[model samples]
Target: MIIADLHPGLPFFLGALVVLVTPLRYRWIPLLLTPLLGFINLMGWELGTTTELTFLGFTLNPVRVDRLSYLFGILFHIAAFLGILFSLHLKDRMQHIAGLCYAGSAIGAVFAGDLLTLFIFWELLALTSSLLIFARREPRAFRSGTRYLIFQVGSGVLLLAGTIVYFNDSSSLLFEHIGLTSTAGWLIFLAFGIKSAFPLLHNWLTDAYPEATPTGTVFLSAFTTKVAVYALARGFPGTELLIYIGVTMTCFPIFYAVIENDLRRVLAYSMINQIGFMICGIGIGTELAINGAISHAFNDVIFKSLLMMTMGAVLFRTGKINGSDLGGLYKSMPKTAAFCLIGAASISAFPLFSGFVSKSMVMAAALEEGYHWVWIGLLFASAGVFHHAGIKIPFFAFFSHDAGIRVKEAPTNMLFAMGLAALLCIGIGSYPWILYDLLPFPVSYLPFDNTHVIAQLQLLFFSALAFVWLKLSGIYPPELRSINLDFEWVYRKLVPTQFSNLVSAYQRFAEIAHRLWVYSSRRLEVAGRRLHGPDGQLSKTWMTGSMIVIVLLTLSAVLLKNLL
Candidate 1:
C-alpha cells in the first residue's frame, strides 16, 4: 500500500516485526520512524474517511477517520514517539517491540468504527502492554503483569460480550453513542469502567505500574486508560452516573496519594485524579465539556509522561523512588529537577501551564449545567491534586532534606525526551487556542479570564499553604516502611483467606458425608439380599404346592356364591 493509503497504525505493528531482526546498532531507525510514518499516514486523510471490510458476514469499518478519532490518533502518535525516544537506551529488544505494538494497538482502537474492530485492537492493547510489564524481568513484575492482564483482558471480554448482545438486540455493530438503556450499554459501560479504573476496580493500576521497568511505566501510563476515556466519550457521553463516578475518582485518590510511599504509585493515583476531570467533562456532555476533556487528555499525555520520565530517570540513576529515600537530588540532577517541577506545575493546573487552559473548561461546564455540587466537588479535587501530585511529588523527591545519596544526572537520551515534553507543556499552556482548535467541537471558551485566574491561584496557594503548615506542625503523614491498604485488600487478602477456610470446611463436611453414605449403602445392599436372594426364606418348592391348594379353595368359594 502507498504511504498515504496505508493504515495509520500499521507501520508501528509492521515495524515491530522489523525491529526484532534489526541489529542493536541500527534498531533506532525503525523505532523512531514507525510513529513518524504513522503520523504522516494519519495526516493524509480528511475527516469522515473510512475503510471497510467484510468478515464472518459482518460489515466492519476498521479505519474511520473523523474529528474525535483523529484527535486521539494524533495524540497517540506523539505519545508513541515520546515513549520510543525515552526508551532508546534500553538493551532489551522485548521492551522496544512491546512498546511499539502496544502503541499501535491503541492507535488502531482509536480509529476503529465498529465494536468488533475496536475489540480486536482492545485485546491487542492488553496483550502487548502486558509484555512491557513482564519486560521488567522480576517476579513482582510477572505477578503484577498477570493482574494487569486479567483486568485488561477482562475488559475486552466484556466488550465482546456486550457487542454480541447489542448486535442481537439492535442488529448493528456501529460504534456510536449508546446510552445506558439496555443490558448491552451497561455491560459496555462496565467494560470501559474497569479499564478507566473505576473506584473499586482501580487497584490494578496502582499495583502494577510501580512494578514495571521505568520505561515500561511510561508506556503503561499513556495508552490503556486514555483509550478507555476515548471510548467512554464516544459511547457514553452525558451519562449522569459518570459525573458522580468521576467525582469519586477525583476525590478518593487524593487521600491515598498523600500517604503513599512509592513515588510512581503516587503518580498512578494522581493519574486517576486527572482522568476524573476528563470523565466529568465527558459526563457533562456539552460541546465545551467534550472539548475540555479531549484537550486535557492531550495535555495530560505529554505532562504525565514527562513526570514519569523524570521519575524513571531517578530510578535509573539512584536505584530508589520512595519519597522517604529520595531527597536533595536537585543539587546533582538540576535539569531533571527543573523538568519535574514543570510537570508538577502542569498537573497542579498552575496559570500559564498546560493544565490551566483545559481543566477550567470542565469546571465552567459544571457550573453552566447548574451542577453546583459537582463543580464544588471538582474544585476540591483540584486542590487535593495540587497537594499530593503537585507539591508533594516534587517536594519530597527533589527538594526535601538531603538523603546523603549522590549520583550522576539522567542520561542524554532521557534528558532529551524530558526536554521535548517540557517544551510541549509550556507551548500548549502558552497557546491554548492551538489545542482548542483540535478539539472535536468548535472552540470559544476562554481559560485566562481575571476571575478564573485569580480563583485558581487562590485555591492552589491555599492548598500549598496548608501543606506547608501541616508539614511544619508534624501533622502530615510521615513516609514509613509499611504497607498501606486500599479496597484491593478485600480481594488480595480477605477474600482469599475466607475462600480457603470455606474450602477446608467443605472438605471436612464431604468426608463425614462420604462415611455415612458408605454405611447406609452397605446396609441397603444386605437388606436387599435378605429379601430377594435365591434359596432364602419362602423361596423353596413349598411355594408351588401351597399356591395350587389356595387356588382350588378360592375357585370352590366363588362357584358357591355365584349359584346362591
Candidate 2:
C-alpha cells in the first residue's frame, strides 16, 4: 500500500506547480516545507523497497531503494532545504519553482531503477536548472544559460541514445553496474562524463555558474553534476580510464582557477578540482574508495554551497563579485568573512575540516591499490587547490587591500543558512563517523591517525608558505580586470568567428556568380535582338539572292559526294 503512494521526490515536483498559485506573502512555507516533506517521505521507505509498473509493454521499476540511493536522497533533501532557506529573501517566484523542480529531478534520478526513468528526470534537471540562470534577466546571463542548456540537454540526448542501444543489446533496463566494453556502455559513460564536467566537456560550468543570479548559483552548485557523480559511482566504478581523467581534472583546473578574476568563476573551477578527487576514488573501486568518493561528494555539496552563499552575499550586498573590485569586506561583513574561512578550510582539507576526513580515504585507497603516480598527482592537486581556492578566495575577497567599498552584512536568513552549513562542516570534520555511518559500505578506516594528520598539516603549511612567499615577492597572480579564455573560446569565439567568415565568403561568391550570370544573359539578349531586328543583315532583302545561291551550292556538293 505504501508503494502505491507517490515517489518521495514527487512532492517537490508537485510543490513547483503549487508555487505558481501560492500567494507571494506565504511562499516560504511551501519552499521550506516541500523539502521537509520529501525528506520525511524518503525516511518512510525501507531499504530494498521496490515499485513496479507496466509502461509501453515493459515492466518498469520506477523506485528501487538501497543504501546508495538512500544516502543521496538524504543528501539532496538537506541541500534543497539549505538552498531554499538561503533564498528566503528572494521574491522571484520563477526561481523558487525552478529550484524545486531541479532538486526534485535530481532526487528522482538517483532513485530511478531503470534508465528510461532516469532519462526523464535527466532532461527535466536540465530544463529546470537553466531557468535559474535565465532568471538573471540579462543578455549575458541569457547567452550563458543557453550554452548551459546545450551541454545539459546534449548530455540527456546521449543518455537516451545510450539507453536505447543498451536496452537493445541486453534486453533489460535495470540501472546497475555496466562495464565499458560495449558500444552502449561507452555511450552511457560519455553521457555521464559530460554531466560530471570531465575535462574539455567542462566549460559549461565556468560559463554559466557566475552568470546566474546570486541565490541561483547556490542552487546550481548542488545537484546537476553530483547526480552525474552518482551515476558514475553506480554504473562505472573501477573503470581505469576514470583515474587518468580524474587526475587530469584535478590538475588542469588549478591553473584556470589561479588566474580567473571572477571569484564565482574561481569557485566553479574549484568545483571541478573537488570532483576530480571523487572520480579518482571511484576509479580505485575498493570498498574504502567508493565510500570515500560518495562521502566527499556529500561534504562538497555542503561546503561548496557555503562558499557560494558567502560570495552571493557579497554580490547581493555590494553588487560586485570580481576579486579586482572587492576587498577588506571583513570590516562590515565579518560574519560572512568568518564563514568563508571555514568554507576555505573545509575545502582545503584542513585537519579539522570536512574535506580532510573524506579526501584522505581516497588518497589512502590509491596508495593501497598501488596507483603510485595517481597518488602523487592527487597530492599535487591537493596542494594546488589549497593554493588557489583555499588561499586565493578568502584572501582576495575578504582580507586583501581595501577597495574602499563599504556594504552591509548579508541578510539574516543568508547568515542563518551559511551558519548552519558551517556547523555541519565542523561537525562532520570533528566527527566524520556520523557521515561515515551513512556511507554505502561500512567505513572502518580512521582519518585522524597521527602520521596522516602530520603529513596533511605539513602539506597545508608549506602550501601557505609558498603562497605567502609568492605574494610578498610579487610573483603571485594579481586580481585584474580582464577576460581569461578557456576551452569555451573554441565555440564562443573561434567557431562563431569562423562561421561568420564562412557566411561572408558565401555571400561574396554568390555576388560574383550573380554578376557573371547577368552579364552573360545581357550579351545573349543583345545578340538575339541584333539577329532578329529589321535593320540586321540577315533580315534584309539580300537574303532572297543568298538563299538561291545557297540551294545551288548544296545541290553541287551532294553530286560531288555521290561521284566520290
Count of clashes, each model: 0, 0
Q: On residues 1-564, what C-alpha lDDT tens digit does candidate 1 reach at each position?
A: 268888778989999999999999999999999998888888888899988989999989999999999999999999999999999999899999999999999999999999999999999999999998899889988988998999999999999999999999999999999989999999999999999999999999999988899999999999999999999999999998999998889999999999898999999999999999999999999998898888989999989999999999999999999988999999989999999999999999999999999999999999999999999999999999999989988898899899888999998989999999999999999888888888899988888889999999999999999999999999988887565899889988999999999999999999999999999999998877776668556455567878899999999999999999
TM-score list, all predictions? 0.91, 0.97
Q: After superposition, how far is residue 326 of candidate 1 from its true place, in Å?
A: 1.4
Lowest lDDT 10-mer window, candidate 1?
532-541
Candidates' C-alpha lDDT: 0.92, 0.93
Backbone clash pairs in model 1 (N, Cα, C under 3 Å; residues 3+ apart or in different chains), count: 0
- Candidate 1 yields a Cα-based lDDT of 0.92
lDDT (tens digit, per residue) of candidate 2 on 1-564: 452367977989888888889999998888888998888788888999989988998778898889999899999999998899999999999999999999999999999999999999999999999999999999999999999999999999999999999999999999899989999999899999999999999999999999999999998999998999999999999999998999899899999899999999999999999999999999989999999999999999999999999999999999999999999999989999999999999999998899999999999999999999999999999999899889999999999999888888999999999999999999999999889999999989989999889999999999999999999999998998897888899999999999999999999999999999999999998887788677765576766888899999999999999999
Error of 1 at 20 (Å): 0.7
Measured with C-alpha atoms, the lDDT of residue 126 in candidate 1 is 95
